[model samples]
Target: MKWYFVLACYLLAPAIAFCNSYGMGLTNLNLAPTYGKIALFVFSSLVGSDGGVIAGLAACGIIMSIVCSAADLMQDFKSSYLTLSSPRSLFVFQMICVAIGCIIAPLALWLFWTAFDIGDPDGEYKAPFAVIFREMAIIGIEGFAALPKHCLEICCVFFLAALIVSLLKDATPSHVSSFIPIPMAMAVPFYIGAYFGVDMFMGTLILFAWQKMNRREADGYAVAAASGLICGDRVWSIPAAVLSILRVDPPICMNFRPTSASV
Candidate 1:
């Protein structure tokens, strides 16, 4: 049975490598469902794993695959930081923070859904938040709804917060580690904030234009300009999204801090 499992993983290695090269984490995870089906078939063919035994093994493998994938993601982050010559001490601290951040993700999600009721009305779900609920439902099976809501809220909130801060502040893992609690405080969806950020930036451009024309407005106009900027920024997403699709790989480094001493 053990050898069979090893063989299965070996066969799947090529597929996994291809997915990784494409930077498709979701596609990689999706393969586990197929692997689960294949494992059951193998178990039945080789050792006569009956319904109960087969089901149990399949469940275990699926869980193990998710765990391994998440670990790989962490290692990827660690490698990226090292590639940029981040301090060893800072990297270790950030890893610890990342662990804490992972725990917080689900809890954050539960809270958001509880507060905003943000799910598909027909049960189809979306993203960082959906993952928490979907995994819980799968693992808990019969008792999924009975799971603690706070746990759901934390995880969803934490991951998004990390992504948003990474996007907006250009924070390094070290900076993220130091201000780990901020994401939990305001659980905005990362994409939503990003949209707003674009609008704000555009408004700023308009304001600068007006200022150059000697048409400076009152303080109230400043606030209005800010709002307009946020609205305009969403237009920028079209180009960014297109670029992301063209670029198969996500950028390895983000939120870099430069040395002013170079000046």
Candidate 2:
């Protein structure tokens, strides 16, 4: 919450980025939640429990942002490596994007909050991640024993299964191991819901069709198309948020609900 804490986070960004480049990003991600909890515990001890939750949430955001930015930078570096492009240029571009995002993301959130009731359970945007984060923060503050029994059991099962699969994947031949389902990808739907999985499935099917049609052009076309789609999806969010601010409700927004009153 203090200015010094904020400055420390910025100063640590380059170190985080370096670690990620060397494949230590996963280690950082694994440790981040624990570190956040420790940071929150310290903040609570210093400031009392009254405003500690807000400070804790800010700490979580800062940690998550650093880890995510580093992971993204590593991805960009991989893309640049494959393309024989300049990593410095990519890093500069990413920094510019991060600066813009830091300004724009909060504005979009504020606009949406103003335009619609955000925290309502029945709202169009359920803010599922926010709910998850809040629950995690509570767990951090209280302790793991506070988590539901069934949730703990399920977590244990998945953790064991993931460990086994990771060992198996490493031991197996590369050609055979390529078929193994990514543990993270398999687990994503549990946290983010099935919509993202559905989108990924659809994209895979499209890519398959493209490869079948023309394997030669598929690589180039697929990369270009995927990049365009990713950019378009994010770019559209800005205008959509602007429209929300302008109170422009389109017919497409209404289509989310059923038209039949009988239902």
Candidate 3:
């Protein structure tokens, strides 16, 4: 990891990340982020403490963006393919979006950065993840000795479980395997809560019901309908975030609670 080589990597990282990350999905497992993590940890280990912390932070951010972009692009491509869109056209569209994102993302970040003390531990927001990620880099440099009690063991156990599940899925027949829950997908609920899982289950039920009632119509427009609903819900968050940043509360508030506090 020479300075010159690292510089070259920065120049070619997007292309390299896209290929390795997306190509990995086609080959077997789609652990795009893991590749980025390995690069971060290994690079951190090779550098001194100050350099490791600073460079590792930069590397972690870049790796995350690149790997995440690749995975997201893969999903977009899948949606396009399902909708009978051309790969060439999708690729061109993606490039254009990437160009726009390159400009917009930085400006949005700059706006937020100016508004909030992002890395400050004592700031209003107190970005705890900054400390966590930095600590991860230090651990990379310090080796397993720096890990919390049972952290290494837990990680190893989960890694093996994911591997075995992936193996079983691949070995099983397609009919049977489709029913097999993806380890990565299953892992999401453990950390993020089962609200999303419930949503997926309900969506699946609706789709199945729709197909049973009218298979042809469901096949034709189900994705578009689902995509529109999801996009609409997500798109509202953009303005909601902007309003919050500007310290403007919404005019209306609604909440459903199981119990209300007595006045």
Candidate 4:
């Protein structure tokens, strides 16, 4: 199933490239950091398994990789389910949304580049997928042999850290498990560490300032702020909110599942 999805991505690569180049426009600021971790995970897993050097290590790396990517999607999904929205509908909506965005993105890029003609006169536009693939290759070359050692370190650190935190806070084991990966990813990767730190601090500050308000109210503010940032205009406020909802993945796998889910 996973391989099929990967193959499908390749099959649709041309369309995705065209969309990115011509339709919706592209910006390095937002997309680069978001996709970087994703690429790291993908590449690390693939490269780690190349020689079948360490079965256990490879397996753990793959799991961490999935957890890393899923964390990003899960946060957005969590926000979506907070409001009234159907889970199945939101899932389908994301599929359609990404398909459209991937197809139109290239067209948007071409226009932006042509308008500015600033950076590369050669019209060299690297699509998101290609960038991801390149990063994966780089990760493979760097850690292909040392994969087992790395994987052991990751698993040990992940569970031990989670356990320590859970014990110290009197939280459940599941709570620790659910919350551990995001911070773990940040620890090794400097760029991701900085970004997550900033984002978490901002979220904490917002929640602290709005301490008197209910969760629902704070959620509303966060959603509004996120929407405004994403849409670039108020006309997209509603749709952005809807997109936020659509992106939320159910927390069937986690203990910290938002209390707001209806389905």
Candidate 5:
């Protein structure tokens, strides 16, 4: 079973490489879904629904773990390179951290699971990315029928647009091309939700203002500031989860969303 998966991954290496390369992926995690979708499509064609769905899901899970770890370790490796730290020592620490995570993660997940309805349609903690991935798997099984009307055509249009954008970027100078949005960047919000777009817009707006005011400080502190904001946001979730488990609900919680539509 393990070797079958290994062989599957080995077979799909070219697709992975192509996606990573042509998609302009800066990190592994974001590109995992693309490869997963590819795997799902290929396997569904090669084998029947029963085997293929399981294989596709298994591949997706493996890919997720692989990419997540790769992205995490790559950041650490780059930081180590900058600081002149021992790679062996860093690897040892990473292994230790992984061991700790293996023990701690389940407990943390249990706490959250108790606190919130994770995948509920009307729940506060809807797992949108999971929904998207599940939809991809369903589409793999049901073919074009699972998708919204003209969804495939829309995707084709975007695909051509992306290709054209890529070519124009190559043809144009750096200054001109920098203004153009990459397809992958655009796809992030599409895969996740509109929230990411809003988040990015705010970040970009702040950075733009900062740059106009003080380019040097903006350039120096932009990444650090963004990192701090992101870290704080995630860290706050722990306390929020704890409060939820304690049966304390925030009085002022509000939700503003569009009418329910499967996008």
Candidate 6:
């Protein structure tokens, strides 16, 4: 399985590099889904039910990586074009970062799992994304009709609301539209916990204030600052997990739940 994963990564690297060179976007690419289906069939045939599940997961991961890399590479290409930077340099740097991530991500996950119970109902980290993925996989295998009627109805409501909001955003003047909440932003809290949405709202409020105070410097620094915040949050999790494993908690309590006594 490890060898197959490595082989797939090796094969994908050149394909991604070729696509990036041609400035081709993956938005309309039908190749990934086809490849995924083929992989699913092959793995299922080679192993059994277990292999089929593994293959499905592997295929999903591969497809996601390809799509994400395509988007990131396209953005990098556009940025390079605007700045008159070397595409070669950008590609090299991207590959270096990718290699570093490949090494670091598994290590971080291992540390996290070792330090604390993941997917625990009463644990701080419930692994919501994992639950979402598992449910999605079950739906994929059982067919959309197998999903609960209430869930389907909720989805329809969100979809219709999003459509209306999208139309309004298109029709409204830019200044007015900018103030309107995105349908996705409004809907996400229903699926994910409210704390995640709170972080997003805080970030949005900070950016809004920054732009209102000085539009010029905001344009230059807002993206960099936000990117740093996002990356720092993830990077800090590694050390925090390490501290947890070492039985050394931070001086300040980062997690605070409201208790009846406090109330």
Better of 4 and 5 by TM-score: 5
Q: Which portions of model 5 show Cα errors greater than 4 Å? A: 1-8, 14-34, 58-73, 81-139, 242-263
Error of 4 at 163 (Å): 5.2
Show pairs that collide, candidate 5: none
lDDT by residue (tens digit), candidate 4, 141-236: 455453566776786887688557646555557666565443323343354456445655665577767756677777668657755554564576
Q: If scored against the real structure, what TM-score would every candidate get?
A: 0.25, 0.53, 0.60, 0.36, 0.62, 0.49
Task: State the number of backbone clashes in model 6.
Answer: 0
Local accuracy of candidate 2 as per-residue lDDT tens digits, 151-172:
7689689889988997888999
Winner by lDDT between candidate 6 and candidate 4: 6
lDDT of 2 at 139: 50
Better by TM-score, candidate 3 or 1: 3
The candidate scoring highest on lDDT is: 3
**Model 5 — TM-score against the truth?**
0.62
Q: Write the per-residue lDDT of candidate 3 for residues 113-134, one digit (tens) a residue.
A: 9999887777787788777777
- Using TM-score as the measure, what is the rank order of every candidate, best first? 5, 3, 2, 6, 4, 1
- Greater TM-score among 3 and 4 belongs to 3
User: CA shift at 50, candidate 6, in angstroms?
Assistant: 15
Highest-scoring model, TM-score: 5
Model 5 lDDT per residue over 34-137, tens place: 66676665555444466656666666766655555545666677678657899899989999998898889889999999988999989898888777866666
Number of backbone collisions per candidate, in order? 30, 0, 0, 19, 0, 0
Query: Candidate 1: lDDT over CA atoms?
Result: 0.50
Candidate 2 accuracy as TM-score: 0.53
Residue 212, candidate 2: alpha-carbon lDDT: 96
Predicted structure 4, TM vs. truth = 0.36
List the RMSD of every prediction in angstroms: 20.8, 9.4, 7.6, 16.3, 7.7, 10.5
